[model samples]
Target chain A: MPVPNRPDRLFRHARSEAIFIASFWLACTVYCCAYCYMYGYITPSRPLTERDVKPIWGVPSWVFWGVFVPWLVCGIVNVVFSAWFVADDDLGEERAAPIADPGGTEADVA
Target chain B: MRDIWRDVLSTGGTRAESAVIFAAEVGSEPKALVALVVFTIASLGLGVAANRFVGREAGFLKKYFLGNRSLGAFAVALTAAVMSGGTFLGFPAFVYAYGWITALWIGSYMVAPLTVLGVMGKRIGRMARRTGAITLPDLFRERFGSPTLGLITSVLVMFFLTCNLIPQFKAGGVIMKKVLPAAATDWATSPPSDDLDIKVDLDTGYMIGLTIFTATVTAYTAYGGFLAAVWTDVFQSVVMAIGVLILLPLSLWSAGGLAAATARGVHDAGIGYAFGPGAGRSFHPITLAVSFFFMWAITSMGQPSTLVRLMAFRDTRTLRYSMIYLTIYNFIIYVPLILIFIAARSVVPGLSKPDEAMPSLVIKLANPYVAGLIMAAPYGAVMSTVSGFLLIIASGLTRDVYQRFLRPHASEKEIALMGHVATVGVGLVVALVALRPPEFLQLIIIFSSAGMAAAFLVPALMGVYWRRATAAGAIAASLAGSGVVIALYALGMLPIEGTIAARLLPANPDIGPASSFRPYYLLGFDPCVWGLASSLVAGIAVSLFTKPPDEARLSLVFDDGPAVEPKFDPPKREVESRGSEEPEAPAEPSATERRNE
Candidate 1:
């Protein structure tokens, strides 16, 4: 059996990370969309009043809970994942310089 | 995000007509002009400084086009996040039209940084380094060893990018025309102190504004290349953040508070505005909600402009840091924007042109000079996006076209010069097009964005991650993706009367029969979902049936062994050779690497 190498490992790492992040995204979408659609989508026939529209910190209840709270949590999750969870693998060296004579420019190409 | 301007107004007219009419009414603001001029001058200065930085680098082509893959975290995050003119103009207009529901409409954007960077960043960055690829098409061509794929990718990128640029140039001109002094033009009649009474012919003003907009943006982009664009984007992002932060408190204060604003907004536009499905049933059912999430996250990964940023970051550390920065930045800009525009419903009520909400509220809330600075947020958006597009188009022309096919033996200096010329040439063409621009500005933006994403996303994802993906598969995927999007749009424009198709998918009456350029939302989901699905299927089926990619090429691009780190200070002779010839080939693979391949 061939030994798994850097490319294979990196691919596996990227795939696993992608799946995790996508799952988090799915969770946020379900909670926020379902919550807003259920609570926020009221019938127009019913008259709306200042009292009837429940608000927290000046934002509507659906917006506060569905959008803002999930948004805040997503931000926290993103920070944690980006800072700690996401690996810092070596990106590899840039391509070698050309084969030629001695004195020239092009110092910091990469 | 599917079509931000499709239903921008609850009334009947389009975004273009509303803009023209609004410009006719609101005369010029002198202080705003001064503020804009100051910002433009500063941007020009940055371009000059960036040119100096590029001049010192070795490979002018790589440095000019990809910043020598040296972008830091802040530059990467800001340039990636500060998308385009729509973020400020179309989005606020969207919020104005559809109350608080705009929150959920744009909510999926929260995952944008993660989705775009985390998934593709490391893979693309590594691939580019290994293949010595500077542009998106370069990566594809190098990986597959197929110049045909390169040419096709180039054509698609250039075509879609130009489509994207025309509307942005038009937007910049419209904003400037909105502020043109009534008495400045010969065909103007100045009224009393009341600005509402003032009326002027906007033809001359529009031309002047477009000319200035074209000159400033084109000059900076052509002069300094990629570094200039990225640095300017960083500067513009700061300006955008400041603009939003300043507007937040003032808008809230003007509307009494968020509570007061929400209450009044409900009173004015109805409770439907504050909730889902919107007042006009805009976000109906559930498919659209899911489609929008896909639009922002999945499609963003496909954009050449955003993908290029991934290839240029200095290290994985930069990528990680940028993700955090982008998350914070999105929250600061978007959440505040949702609050401010919600408040605008109460403060600047009964706006005929909903797209004018941002400027209208700014003028009403802040002083003239301050309003100009705040207006810079949108103007900066236009400039930053235009500059980025110019770089991509120019790189596609010079690197992907001229050097690759026409002049494969061309010298480094010749290619560098061509790069600058191409940037200017594309800008000139786009500016001329903007002079007699199509009526539907927003639709063009929508098409270009979706088309680019559709054409490139699946092929790109497979190329980087899937070992079995073939050149034929990528080509098939690209053609299928672009074809599907165009066909849907074409079918949407046709008069499908008395046909099964007509019954199945009818025209959106709001946009009218002849004028409706929107795609038929199959099952209420955006056309992009269909396009992507088609692309993915074609890529997989074609790859499975056709021969797999060449093993040698695959090994070259995806060798699994530990990379031989290049010495920062190469032997003097090697440095001299770099100037004279092509880069030296990478070291031969180890035994373990070959076994894995």
Candidate 2:
């Protein structure tokens, strides 16, 4: 199947979208980590950074990182794996086969 | 007086005796018999209506497996909520077993509707309307431009759906056994203590009940398609919610009030919250948060049935309403059930299994009528979920596999027929697997959820927001993520024993001892973590090396711009109007123009 026009533009758009998704995911991860710590999943400790300052139900900051970091690392690794697997096939040919109308015209069937 | 009451409550009738007692208690078994018949008839009628309605509106099979993107907010919200059987039945049971803290964790599912509403609901709704993407696999194919990815995703979804359905069937069988036992005259005279295990005659009443329930659900879903399933789900949700609420207060009153129930629970089980005593157990704050986060994330990304709802909506506004309605429904139905579970735990201590607690409590505490109604809730839940799963699987086979691969030019009517066939086929497979029930129904649900979450979550999410989310990447990630989780599970890495892995792996971690490590009992991590990790990594790495999806696809998927105005040629429209008046004039393309590829 023939590729659509504007390859470079498509590449750039795709790149930006990937980054945006990764960022959104990261934000969700951070929120979950903070919530977990507050709920008493880990032992209480002092804050390591300003971003960790918000305490929930009086949970300490250090305990937040204890669970958050490990989870984050695991999440990151998973994200990387997903990206790799999903990118295995060529998008153009795969997409084009279904939508592309070769020779069939509107008049032919009608 | 207390001893007599206790004896009455604790007596465990044998299967033969239980049948007689159940008959006597239920006032001649006719009411129970009538209820079952009524439920089956109602389900079938609604199901046929749903199927026919969708068929008429969608033009046979042109809309084919999908109902032509015609779902409203009410149907979609109910369908998504009812998809998870564990969420409905297990939440109350989890609360009963653990406590408020665990209930809080399970209650976090309430946040799911919000997550979908805030993030994916409107956006997907708009895109689905514009693109006419019927399934999540279809969306993946369109957005990322890859059929391989679509196929892989569909297979993964089917696998998850199958796994999810198994537990529902098992739960149904178990419930039937509990509710109806075979008649035996001699056993009725002597009652066994609660501690004694009562044998159930599964060949007669229990088997018949299970077969009828499964068969009815399967038939309608197979015949009616997605529309039938969704509409019936709304009714099921209503039934389930009403049943649970009614049982809650009555059960509490029987237990001597909420305070007394809590006091009893505290005295018997000690003062630990739902997450268990350890820091990292199932309900541990971190684990709960992570579990909920993953749950929300995975469902948001794919979940074919839920995505189909997005495709069904007329526009984004309707989608918004659906989200709001779903959130309210979850809050009303699920949250209060937690209290009921806790009350049950207080009343019935030392339950052999957590899942059995709610049923046991209802039988012991509530009157026959109330117990019957309450028992209907799980049946409703299981049926709703099973119907939803069967519909999706049928759609995948009919649309993704048959129409997409076998014959692209096949008419909509033909595809619809295929969908019905596929539904029956899938149902048969599920019922067969359910015959040999697993020891832990909850674990099976979790495993399936984790599998789908691992395979599709990252790729689907990224495909929408990131242009670089190539088809290759999505496929690779799904395969790797799902593969790793299954492999690990097979390798005895998880806490589970007696699985394929347990037989292979030596028991001793140090020197090949017979016993192996069970993660839930040892390390705190669930299989979901492993599946998620592998999927995420595979999705990202493959995308980095591969070319990104095209600008058109990306814009179609991610764009939040103003809707494009439909172009109209005045002269062409006039000609078409004139042509329409002529009986045999070549049909104008205008009517079919809006129909999506």
Kindly list the per-residue Cα lDDT of model 1 for residues B1-597, writing each as its tens digit: 213333433222222323333433344667666766776888898888888875464577788888888999999898878544456555777677778877887898788889988888888998888766789997887666566788899999998888878867776776676576655544744222211111222367667778888899999888988988898788868886887899899888888888877767667666667676665455444567777787787888999988898889999999999999999999999999999998898889888656788878888988777776766655666777788889999999887778665776566778778988999999999988877766555565666677888899998988988889988899999889878887776666566788887777755433211124666677667778888999999989998898766444565557664333222123234322111222233333332334458
Count backbone overlaps in model 2.
Answer: 60
For model 1 chain A, the run of ten residues with the poorest summed lDDT: A98-107
Docking class of 1: acceptable
TM-score on B-chain, cand. 1: 0.86
Best by lDDT: 1
What would the per-residue lDDT of candidate 2 be over residues B380-433, giving only the tens digit for each residue? Answer: 556666787787887788767776777666755566567778889888887776
For each candidate in the order shown, give its overall lDDT on alpha carbons.
Answer: 0.72, 0.52
TM-score (chain B) of candidate 2: 0.76
Give the range of the ten consecutive residues with the poorest summed lDDT in model 1 chain B: B192-201
